[model samples]
Target chain A: MARWEPDAQARLQNAALELVARQGFERTTAAEIAEAVGLNRRTFFRHFPDKRDVFFAGQDQIEADLVAGVTGAPPGESPMGLVGLALARAADTFAHLPREQARARQAIIDAEPALLERERQKFAVLARSVGDAMRERGVADLEATLAAESGVLVFKTAFTQWLADGESRSLPLIIAETMAALRALYVTR
Target chain B: MARWEPDAQARLQNAALELVARQGFERTTAAEIAEAVGLNRRTFFRHFPDKRDVFFAGQDQIEADLVAGVTGAPPGESPMGLVGLALARAADTFAHLPREQARARQAIIDAEPALLERERQKFAVLARSVGDAMRERGVADLEATLAAESGVLVFKTAFTQWLADGESRSLPLIIAETMAALRALYVTR
Candidate 1:
């Protein structure tokens, strides 16, 4: 009898990120990743096109959720307010994944130049998509663009810290804190 | 008699970026870049260890100018306000570069993934140094990090639009406008 785990994709992703973190990303092989998780090479390929995709598996859903958060925010908030609320929702969604898993993914990304580039490209894509989503919310051009870029940067900074060792704050809370610190800029002006 | 152009470094940088833009960045070699500028390989190596460094020619000066802008700001300004002013000054310093040259530099950076990563790394370095400079100015930990990161994102977004074809706004003007839009988040709160 075959004992199948329902979360095959996640298990593979965790194994791959861990393997890449333990060894240099360049030295890790697909077969090795599959072997680490007791999955066949074919099954691994079915889940991920390549090793890098393992780390960014939920990318599309993340963008969609982020966009939905922006476009579907409660009315009457300022553009940046709506964007901040949107980012908070986005952080909550990410909070589901274990912090250690995120850190494992980040460790590989931080160590490899090529993976770092891929992460940069993902952020660039996120900014463009988030900007467009805000535009769909009827926000002005420059306003939407600025808020989108700021939200992504805040998310980036907070997410990095949220996964730090001994850290226990929720992603949304960290993001709110970061945004509040930023807002202090205008009050003191 | 050889005619000497004093700005060989600038000429080399221009040649390298253009070459990378025209040909794919990976296909362009250092020898080709030197040949394009009529310099010997040894001369090229003297200026930059490799091809990637050419796109980041102003690395040291940009960091110094940005840090100086933060450290030397007139007292009685909010940390974020000081950062905005410092970013404005940094924008001014960059504005001295010809628009056409900056556009050419950006074109290759935009087109190549590897160059984009190198650019990202440069910005990360800029943010860290800017944060340290703010720390030295007596700003709080989270506040300094957020401001520095925000300053870089603002710079990135403005610099991108500043060099767009048919656009003629000064870098500082674009930066100022971007900051104003961001500051509205606090003002309207």
Candidate 2:
């Protein structure tokens, strides 16, 4: 029961995640989230437009990191390698989340249809951003788009495994293994 | 303008798609959709909860076909082969629409955020269904899910290409080429 003022947004999101886990998304509301975090209704609105916004606040940072990672890869790296680096960067971003927190968030997302759809749009936005970033770096056409999309797909699989395995292993290792698996899936053909 | 009713559900969906294409989804109303199809608004509501449901009417059928194809693949067919067959069935379903109608439908979906999210959910559902079907047929854990997801990914690539190309070439051939490319992407590793 520590009173923290500057971390309101984070506190709100945490509260929302907790309620979503305990009572399910449909039963949770903005007022409940605000009360859970010891904040009033107006303060919650100032931080997030709605309850869904609380779940999505981190997406912008993730997208920015991905773009930065791809753009800042070693000069000689291929498109695939650059994309792989971006995935590694994302793994790093999620490394600090406690395993229970990660699982709770994921379970909430998995159970809610609208949230799942919003999650997909976020991924699609990231993929398109990656594609655009690739094009800026001289990769062209559908090839760039597909490479970016493929990287996101691999990252998703890797993250799923990493989270499900109790977060004992690092995300980068899981991403590497996922990339290797993708290579094998196609290479065997 | 021919008027023939097969099922109330089909008529409502067709009306919705047609109206959305002509007037845009943002402007179309359920009442107008009912008027266009010679059905009462109540009948339309009975079949679909909202306007978005019309474009997705065929989705359940597509997923059913995917499940059937994945589960019914012959004993010797590999996971990739089973994926290929399931996608071919999807292409067959898409092929039934007139090119203009297909393009019109896609255009509407591409322009709407809600519709775009719904479209992603549909693909996710199909992927999950395909994975379940594959699992039922003895495919293992992560591998089955990956194969199912990869199949949807390639199918999406092929469909985007086909729509952009105005559906001149064979859908199956385009899908096969995309699948081959995806396979090569990993195989080269």
Candidate 3:
């Protein structure tokens, strides 16, 4: 019942992640990835402009879900509270991925400087999306931006913790802990 | 006595900023920057790797100062306090530059995507430097990194506010305010 061919894209992405994890993003070529998936290079390019593209393809969907989550928070929550809710939702979305798969993905990204830069850019884009969503609900500009950036910070902190060794904690719990840490900074000030 | 040949590097950097501000980072060439500095292109290349290098010449010095500040904080001060002190000091170091020159430098960077990427890389380097300094001080790794990253966030937020229209506040005050906001995030949680 899906509108698009989800399995095909998933296969290509998983193959790219696997090859990149083994050989490194810089060393892994699109041709090898396509061949691994039993698809031609042209079909690979149809799904992604490059290997980096595969890493970023999920971002649009993530942003849409984030916006919806922020906008639909319970009736009386503060702006910051709404942002917290959105981040919790995002953490939950990623929670079902196997730990080994997530670790491999993070390792692939950490090994590539270009991929890290692109990740930063993607975070910036997500921040702007959060800002736009907050503004739509009548929050002003600078505060919206500040809240969005703060949300991304919290999300990054939790994600990093979740990806680390001995981290049996859930992403949502880590996110709540990070929010507490950020709040502690305010209190100490 | 000053340690190095100051005028040559300063003149070259100023010329590059001026040209990039008047024209654009992409449109301005190394030859043009050299000519503006009253030097030949070869002399320009002697001091900087390329045109982009001119914008980031003193980051090493700033990072050194930040590490020193972090390592020397009094016992019992949170890592965040030490980092805030370093950021405030760095902002003050730039305070002597004419406001127009500061704006011009930022304007050139704002106009170039490549320059912005370089700036982000520089910040990441600075963050790692601070984190490493904290690690050397016996702070645990993840906490050290979080504190270091939080410092960079405060610096960035303060810098953006300092550059905003009608913002007559001092850099330290702005940084302190940002720290306060960051702390508030944790408190209200």
Query: Residue by residue across B103-127, what tens digits does model 2's lDDT show?
Result: 7788899999889888898888888
Order of all candidates by DockQ, from best down to worst? Answer: 1, 2, 3
- Sorted on lDDT, best first, the list reads 1, 2, 3
The numbered model that scores best in lDDT is 1
Q: Model 3: runs farther than 4 Å from truth?
A: A1-5, B1-5, B40-42
Best by TM-score: 1
Clashing pairs in 3: A182-B186, A183-B185, A183-B186, A183-B187, A184-B186, A185-B183, A186-B183, A186-B184
lDDT of each: 0.81, 0.80, 0.78
lDDT per residue, candidate 1, A11-88, as tens digits?
888788777877878899888888887888887888887767878877777677778888778876677877776786
Better of 1 and 3 by lDDT: 1
lDDT of candidate 2 at residue B118, scale 0 to 100: 81
Query: Candidate 1: misplaced stretches above 4 Å?
Result: A1-6, A74-77, B1-6, B75-77
- lDDT of predicted model 1: 0.81
**CA shift at A32, candidate 2, in angstroms?**
4.2
Give residue A91's lDDT in candidate 1 (0 to 100): 75
B100-141: candidate 3 lDDT, tens digit per residue: 676778888887888888888888899899989888877676
Q: In candidate 1 chain A, where is summed lDDT lowest over 10 consecutive residues?
A: A1-10
Cα error of candidate 2 at position A42, Å: 3.7
TM-scores for candidates 1 onward, in order = 0.89, 0.88, 0.88
